[model samples]
Target: MNSAVTTLWEEAGFPEQTVIQRAVSDPLLAGQSVVGIAPTGSGKTLAYGIPVLTRLVPNLGPQLLIIVPAQELAIQIRDVLTPLAHRLNLGVLGLIGSANRQRQIDRLKGKPAVIVATLGRLADLIDERKLRLVDIKTVIVDEFDSFETEDITTIRHMRQDGLLAGANLGLFSATRNDDDIAAFREFWPDLQVFDEIKTDDTRGPVTHYLLDRQFEGKVQFLERLGREKHQRVFVFFNHKHIMQKVAGSLRFTHVPYSLLATDGRQVQRAEALGDFRRGRTNLLLTTDVAARGLDVADVTAVVNFELPNNITTYIHRTGRTGRMGESGTVYNMGNDHDLRDLRHLLGDSVTLVAEKPLVKKREQDDETNDENTPSTDSHDRARTRPASDKMPARKPTAAKSHNKRKQRWRNKKNVGKHW
Candidate 1:
């Protein structure tokens, strides 16, 4: 073991002979393939990063190619590894959709020791021949289970070309299933198996509040939560049209909320997220689009205006709130249909309480200013779909009003004479 890495791990308070460390240290793993299962925040990044980095030195090529499911997770891993790689004077690059490709291409030419990126963009670069992975010693698919099912074919082709059917392949995820591993093994049936999470219980983040209510009552529940706690809230919807309708209703009700639909421009998505992160906006009305890998640190709650299609989505949606060491709530608001769906998935033991309608309207001036704010796209993708999921091809329509009936929620503790 590298003394520096061992020291760093000890400083991190990580246990010795952890699953991650063992996987990284095994002699056979250098150029082998395996499925890695580990709990969230369980030092998985370092586990793979260390071995990959060691291969890069004295070797000439992009030794490691890490494919993450989300841009934020790519950024998070990049942040986590770049520093550690630097400790050994190694080069690391982040290739993400939101960032410039020209720069990434320019850096790729330098033969970076490691490249961390999302699958779509990274695969695009590989297809374009901008980054050759022929000499990649390690190929880490961070969230193999989350990769878009449609892209699995493409991934197989790339694996053949990039890995030359021989590079070491490592797949890691917090939640893993035997079926997923079996499917992955079909890609390389000879691959070794490491089928276990270090922790026995891989609990998810956030406090789940499964609320049984009318479809219309969700807004009232959210309005109350917003007033009771002046913190950021991410509201999710399974359908984009439903999310748009929800945004329109919030506008009509003068609710303090912003819609982040996926159909908007990249800059708009970035700005909406920035506004939320910077505390310029307290309540955000979005769909699962914002659920994956977003670092909206102080998000006090995740309001599921609609239930997710599956248990995995439920885990990811709630994971957004209870991030790092901070605790938060996940409120799943639903109708009778939603309740039935939940019963089929989570059993009937979960209890839900009826919360009072909470509303503290914005001041007259704030309302006027909100009207001046630009209107949100009814086709907003952020409020509707997760990045990994695709939307159906459809025609567009006319634009809607931006400053739709927004009520400013200034603190009641500081209500001025203007109010």
Candidate 2:
């Protein structure tokens, strides 16, 4: 590590390195092309930020180019690294979609050491000749899995056009599957992959629960849970309409809440996120747009009003809580179909909880009846029915018997295989 950069890093109060930082810091600083996979809030920004900052030379025109999927994430990365860059007498510019293009061009005149930009804005600026990548030494792509093919193509074109010639590339994200890795490797054949992600076991101290309920029932359940728990909460939905409906339901129930979604105005989104972060509102209703990059501490619970389509979305949604070893809980509300999908994705990692009181009462009554009845008599009664009973029984077929025997033998053979 560079001595000046080390002093600035320590001064920034990050004395201890996270697992990702420790793993990739050396390789990244050594100018190696690395692809890092780690959980959200694992200090990935700093892990790559340190390498970029350490290698930066002042007044050298943009030496680092950081591309993100969303403008919000671009601003976030700029906010995190700007102070550190300023400490070293370096400039950092954020080029996002919702900002003034001419103003950004004016800032580019100074030639900041680092430029954080969204994929679309960066491409536009590069095409207009407003931004040049000739001096770039490193190109960091954050949240690479969420990027579209066109975005990836832009990066490939940069390299092909010699704009980013000899620049080391680093891709970082919390979600990277086999297909994502394979797709990335097709573009950069020599990219080194490093994965430290343990989504199942390393989610800090989060407890996951599946609630059996439909859409309306989930809204009621969420209202009840919100009234009962006095902690910060985030309720996620898959669509903007669903998020709006949930927000209306919360408002009707007199629950203090705020909305954050992609459809909302930028100012409203900023104010809503700020209000939730500052504890002005305890509940935040949002969609997957707020799933990956938004980081808010003190969130003790996450509620999935609608279950995500895949395990990766589920991981990022629940990752809003239980951050940095603090204990948190995630409640997933779903019906039978949703439950089946959740089970297939999470396996036995999630606990099922009955959402309605009637269901719980009925289950308790069944348990009581089982305890009070005689086992032998109950079995005989179940097998033999009276003439008054309308239902009829038929004898089992030879094929059924043979299949039962085969299943029994297979079970016996694989008694402890799964355990």
Task: Give the whole-model CA lDDT for all candidates, comma-separated.
Answer: 0.66, 0.80
Q: How many residue pairs clash in each candidate at the backbone level?
A: 13, 0
**Candidate 2 lDDT over residue span 1-419, tens digit each:** 67865786696678877777777888878888888888877788888997678788889899999988876678788988998898877899999877889999999999799999988788899999988899898889998888777767778888888998878888988877666656656656778888887532335677777788877888887777666645788888888878877877777667778787765666887788788888877888887766457777778889888888887788778877887878888888887888778888876645555444323577788888899976666547866867577365689999999999999998787654410
Q: Worst lDDT window (10 residues) for model 2?
A: 351-360
lDDT of 1: 0.66
**Pairs of residues at least 3 apart in sequence or in different chains that clash in candidate 2:** none
Off by over 4 Å in 1: 7-32, 39-43, 162-164, 190-207, 230-232, 248-261, 278-280, 295-299, 322-327, 348-419
Residue-level lDDT of model 1, residues 1-419, one tens digit each, is 66655755664456664565576455433566777775554456776766566556733657788887777577768877776677666778889887788988988776668888887788788778787877777778886777766655566776655454556678776666566666666677766666555342323345566677785777667656655646888888888888877666666555566667656665676676677777776677776644454545667777878887877676556655654456777777777677667767765433444432233355555666778976666577555777667566664433322222222333443343220
Clashes, model 2: 0
Give per-residue lDDT, candidate 1, residue 418.
22
Best by TM-score: 2
